[model samples]
Target: MKMIKTAFCLGLVWGASAYADPELHFVDLQEFNAALDAIEAGESPLSAMESYVAQASPVFQAYAQRYETSAASIADAYSERPGYYRSLPELEGYIRLREPEIVSALSRLEAMAPAGEVVPTYFMVADQRAGGTPVLAAGAAGPQINIAVAVDMIALTAETDMSEFPGGTGGRAEASDLPQVVIHENAHVLQLAAQGGLEAYRSIYSPEGGNMLAVAVREGCAEYLTYLASGWRLGDRHVYGEANERALWSEFEAVMDAPPFSVPGWFSGRHPDHADWPAQIGYWMGFRICEYHHQSAADSDAAVRDLFTLYRPDDLRPLAEAYGASLSAN
Candidate 1:
């Protein structure tokens, strides 16, 4: 108890000390209002963060265990704080207080992280709130996240809480489809870190739109990475009832050749022929891209080093261009 309290106090002190200005890390209260206004105006703040905290709970615990408090300890310490009660603050201030430490840790991780290796493993959660903000844990959420318990959420409706989906299939995300969202958000973190240039996004999309290929690479990479990282291919579910690998592979091959746009479990966009498996296409293509690059590397570490280089759109255009590997082919 004493040690936990000490660490808790230290965290607060660190936050207070680092910020001679109490307003450190403060979101322009206006920005949040602007986000709500935009949402009201039909805009999405999916990526526009009110604020960013590098240390997700897992990152915080890893960091604290090595240096301060473990995640369990921090959670324990929160028992003493008022805002963390049953009716915790909607934005959760303690979660905010620890943000600096989390960011610092993530930065340090970026330096030591091996390329092509999954993000540091501490940054993922299977089920987060729907319509909630995306969180970063390790390596820009890397290209994939650990997915569990979530794929089944959209299938069940009678039960509630962790045991079942509250609103049922009508609520949010089908079991086979949840991974797309998981992969898409992680891809954003990866892409943003790999090469900050988004002028292309502006060129491809209107103020109201976003580029399809860019979105594909991001989403596809997430999908690919999720499988590479966990071996669960949501797309595989497409042929779940089939017993033969030959038949399954054949069906999958067809889906690949088919434009993925609006395929229920893959992608959403139609203009670019987005797939319900938008993320899967990324997985399908992005994995090949990463694998090709990873194998080309002189060493495993080089994989991470070269991740940024792989961000170029030219690498993906071939997938849609002549002589490009057809989406259906392995």
Candidate 2:
């Protein structure tokens, strides 16, 4: 959660007062496309990839500085998955085609955002765990919070071949799904901003401390807010969770408070204890908690805001318990 400084293409500093509205950046994707073109022209993969990193946008440069590995590692990854890399031209084209729609969807979020809050989002090509992530990029002025979307990854669909890729494509998203993914990640940044900043948010909600509930609620709130912002549900997990709510709840209630690493299935992307369950069903459980809290609150708007403001795992305990109690009553 500590701020990670990055060297951006533009020397402009990060200051909120300078911006009237949230900014969207696509320079990273363009740079990645240029790198691909360089690689196609017989340039060394490492050289092209390093150049891409060097020329990436501020948020994406921060993403690389924090989440990515060496240029050699990325070159190796590219070499290993030639098919994935080969498809990039088409993927990038598809993403560009959908840019207008994505921009419109992102516009909808500004109205939904907290007053005067600027959550800049960047579309980039990078190796990342998820399609989108909250990142911190700092220049001389100070650290600025941003949402970085892995446009290349999000452009993948279920049919996308990722077998040769180092990390199996667990969360593949279609180009059309970009809006919801960006919105969900944007909400995550707001959640951090709500509790001071990333480091502050991390202090209270950490999986290492066995506060899995907090982590769940954090993700759940994002998903729920994503739904509120855009009519789409976050993922198929919600559909599955709704279909088997009673059973899923029973299982989740047991380990919702457990040390998540020991379980390795709830949010770890590993298969759950029950063979039939999808990985990361914990998101569904957390969504239910937040959804129920919002529904039962006298002021739904306040409850929604509280999702960002409330800081403690214990703050969500009552909601979880109340939801569980209601489940039992039924």
Candidate 3:
């Protein structure tokens, strides 16, 4: 149950009685270290790992429920890539080194987010096979959304081949992208909080008549905010989208309301039309939509809040169209 807690006074600007103190839990590293030690000692890691999960901090336990954190799943993952598992301890060291900066980055959220919102952040070395990032889970204590980061995956070297991974090259990032991913995902947590709650936010992504534009704009908003906060972009999508804006928007508009996996796979992995293009180009379009809308809004704070508050296609279509119209004008 070891975790670090910090509370920041966001002042009285956002019109709140109080703001929830954000907590960062590094208990996952403790669990991994204990389990790794047992493995090296020629002892079973299952017992230690299980005990750790049972006694884990509330945040880590919530993350465990979403992903396969069982010893068997982890052992299987280790069996596949023993070298990767071994690298985690060293990565744990890396996370510790960057912890201060990570906390500082997360602290910036106070101004952007609604007051009294609690975002519990967790850093963990978990099973990479589960594909952990932007990790948000619902718990009994309101929306228990924790940003569960896979330290191992983020620590992967750029030179390492990711072609065999789930999203291939399209759905991955290197160690350097860690700060941006954390901030981007943190923005998502606040966005979900603003858009009702986790369940409400989840409803928008339903495959049944789900609007890809909504998903795109939602992610785009986060991407845009991440850039504003951390000055980092998600892969090369922003650059690629900027260079080929007109053509991409032309293709994107037709399928923006289609299911997320409809055609070009804009938000999903692998763009079918262009093999060389980066993955999730929908993110770029979404980013642009939010950027244009935010820039045009008279009230900056209200404009930023609107990005997360209205996630439906009906609400966001106007913004997208306005951006599209502006594109034509340009």
In terms of lDDT, which candidate is strongest? 2
CA lDDT scores, all candidates in order: 0.32, 0.67, 0.65
TM-scores for all candidates? 0.35, 0.84, 0.79
| Residue range 127-225, candidate 2, lDDT tens digits | 544567767676446666677777656666665675774565565656667767767776766665566554443443335543777767877777787
lDDT of 3 by residue, 1-330 (tens): 101111111121121222255556677777777777777888665665565566566555555665646666666666666666666656556656776776676777646776325365677765563333444344454334456776655666754544334445336556766667777777876675676553333445656634788778878888888777667785666778889999988988887887755666676556656876676788788899999999998998998888767766688889999999999998
Pairs with backbone N, CA or C atoms under 3 Å apart (clashes), candidate 2 = none
lDDT of 1: 0.32
Segments of candidate 1 deviating more than 4 angstroms: 1-187, 197-213, 225-266, 269-312, 318-330
Tens digits of lDDT, candidate 1, 1-330: 000111221111111122221111223222333433443465433322212112233333233333343323323322332121112112224325544543443343334323211122222211222211222223332322221111212222222233222322333433333323333333333443344222222221121223334344444444444444334444443243223334323333344433323233333322233222232333344344444445545685655444433433455454333213432353
Quick one: ranking by TM-score, best first?
2, 3, 1
Clashes of 3: 0
Error of 3 at 64 (Å): 4.0
Give residue 13's lDDT in candidate 2 (0 to 100).
32
Which regions of candidate 2 deviate over 4 angstroms?
1-18, 89-116, 139-141, 162-168, 198-202, 205-210, 260-262
Sort every candidate by lDDT, greatest first.
2, 3, 1
- Per-residue lDDT of 292 in model 1: 49
